[model samples]
Structures are given as structure tokens and as C-alpha cells.
Target: MKRRTKIVVLGSALLLTAGAASAATASEAPSPRGAAVSEAPRPHEAAAPETDRPREAAALTGTAKLHRSAGDDITFSFDAHLAAKDKADPMKATGTFAFSHYQNGDGARAEVAVDCLLTGGKVAVVSGIVTESDLPGVEGKRVGVTVHDLGRHDRLGYSWAATGTPAEMDGLPKCVSSAPFEKVAKGTGDFTVVPWQPEF
Candidate 1:
């Protein structure tokens, strides 16, 4: 016709440039061995942080009967045990502290062993040393006591209650105590003191 219409329009422009160069070489191929090809999506992960814990050590028994200032009449007891807050020896405690004293016929009795124990709530502050004694010169010496349960009016104090003269207090070192004041004319029991923490 007009030269076969220009050779059929140059073979339809070389079959439209070989179908766009075979779709740019199959989009730059690379994905055949078990091909699944299709990925782009990932991002999500982050969380973790919180910690703090440590504290426990407290126990001091009781048996009271204190009333000083003139009538004199002491008789306190406790079976202590405390020391473990990372313990660098908060006086490292153990147990035992039994005392007795009268006034009329003059009396004395002692037995300490524990070593430093301090509390805050029900109040407590026990020192120790006197292994055993009939009270004279306070056996080995190194006492300290102070209670204050106060439910039925419990209270006591003695570093050797009113010893020698001017309100003496012949022993007191480790954790030196004092602050149950005094006053427990005659109690039966229940002074389970508990509260404790770096407190003095």
C-alpha cells in the first residue's frame, strides 16, 4: 500500500520497544530459589525497668515490774534477737537480759548477755554484758535497758537504777539506751516491742 504502510509502522515501533525492555528486566530480577519476594515493614520493641527491696530484723520479749524514784522495785526481762539489715553489726544482738531488784530488804539480781538492740515504735533499747550476777559491782558490767510498751502502763529504765549516789548508771556502751523514763510499779507481761530501722 504506501510501502506496506511504512512497514506496518516500523513493526509497531518494534513491538513497543519490546514491551518496555521486558519491564526493565523483570524489575531488576533477583528472587527465584523459593521466591516469595515482597517485604518492607518492621519496627516495634522497648520496655523494662524497676527495682528496690531490703529490710527486716526485730524481736524483743518482755516481763516488767519497775517503779523507781524512792520505792525502788525493778524486775525486767527480755529474750532479745536482732541484727540483719545488711548487718555491719548494729551491735549484733543475741538474747537474754533478766534483772531483779527490791528495796525494803535491799536486793539485786542480774543476767545480761544480748548486745545492743534498738527499736522505735513500742520503744526499746537494750544493751548487755553482765554475764550473770548477784548484782555487786555488776558482774562484768555494761548494762542498759529501757522499755515502754504502754498498753497497761508498761515502762522501765535501768543502767543500774539509782546506784551509788546521784542517780548512778554504772554501765552503758553499745547502743547506749535510755528513754522508757520509768514507771511500771508491777506489770505481768506483754511488751513485745517491734518497730525498728536505722533509728537511734
Candidate 2:
């Protein structure tokens, strides 16, 4: 009986040891559905190329005269530059904008200090505060302007054109304006614009 008991004890010890070893092995093994691991680039394959993106620096300098009718016309000039590193007024600009409108034989002109400028492709939107004006109620008011350089077919638009509503004249924000949809007069002037993608 004593020898039988001894054999049973020995067999149980070996089985427990084997079970513990098996559990450890299972724990250390990687699962087939585990998280993916990134592989190193192949020797013959070139590294992936980065996407092309536009820089934040841009410049726009142009002048144009647009005719509205036989005796009405609008002329403007812009010398604006943008190098945005943050969101602030003037958009880091050192530029000026001048506009003139002639109706029959009467004329009015306004000069502005640039506040903001945004450009993309051949289009640019500019906003400024009127520093001097011959037009009534325009001085000290914010105004918006837009321009499009289409080679010989440049266009321009203004927020204060056509006597806008009180909200439009008083509540216009920086860097906001309408599209440049008005056509430039043939042989009147030309516009040159350089645009860049703005980081929003």
C-alpha cells in the first residue's frame, strides 16, 4: 500500500509541472488575430512621396478700370501682401487699396489701409478700413473688395457698390467680400494677381 501511494504521488507531481509549463508557453505565444506590426520599407522601393500643398505666403498687385455703362466706370488699384503665421487683423499686411468711381462727370474716390487678404489660385478677397474718402459716410467704415485675374479679362467687385444695406456697410468683417463677377472694360487696364492657399 505504501509503495502504491508513493507512485501515485510521483505521477501527480509530474503532471502538475507539465501543466504549468504548457500554460506558460501558451501565454508567451502570439495570437493569430493580434494587432498588426509595421514592416520596414523594402530595399528596392522608394519612400512614399508627400502630398503637394500650397505655401501660406502670397502677393497681389494689380489695377483695373471696369465700365458699368456709357458714362459710368470704376477703377481700383491694390498692392497687398500676406504672410500669415496666425489669426489676427491686417493679416500681417503692409499694403494699400485705392478706388474711384465716375458717373457722368462727377467722381468719388476712397483710399483704404488693408486689414486682411486671402488668396487662392487667381482670385483674392481684400478688406480694409477707409482712411480717406470723397464719398459720404465711407470714411472710417470697413469695406470689402474682390478681384480675379483672368489674363486680359480681369474682373473686380466691391461691398459698398450699389449702395449696400446698412448691415452690409456697417457690419462687414475682416477678410470678407463678394465674388469678382463684374467685367473689366476692354483696353481700360490690366490686373496681375499671385495667389496662395490659406491655412484655415
Residue range 1-200, candidate 2, lDDT tens digits: 23211110100001011123342333345545756874555867743444434334666676767766554556677877775453233377657777766555565677778888877788888887877765566678887788888888888766755444212368788878776867888875566666665445
Cα TM-score per model: 0.30, 0.64
Question: What's each prediction's clash count?
Answer: 0, 0
Give Cα-based local distance difference scores for all models. Answer: 0.58, 0.63
What's the distance in Å from true for residue 30, model 2? 78
In model 2, how large is the Cα lDDT of residue 197?
52
Number of the predicted model whose TM-score against the real structure is largest: 2
lDDT of 1 by residue, 73-180 (tens): 556668776855634454777877676655565555666787778777888887877676654455666767778787668876655444431113453578575556
- Name the candidate that leads on lDDT: 2
What's model 1's TM-score? 0.30
Q: Residue 41 of candidate 2: its Cα lDDT?
A: 51
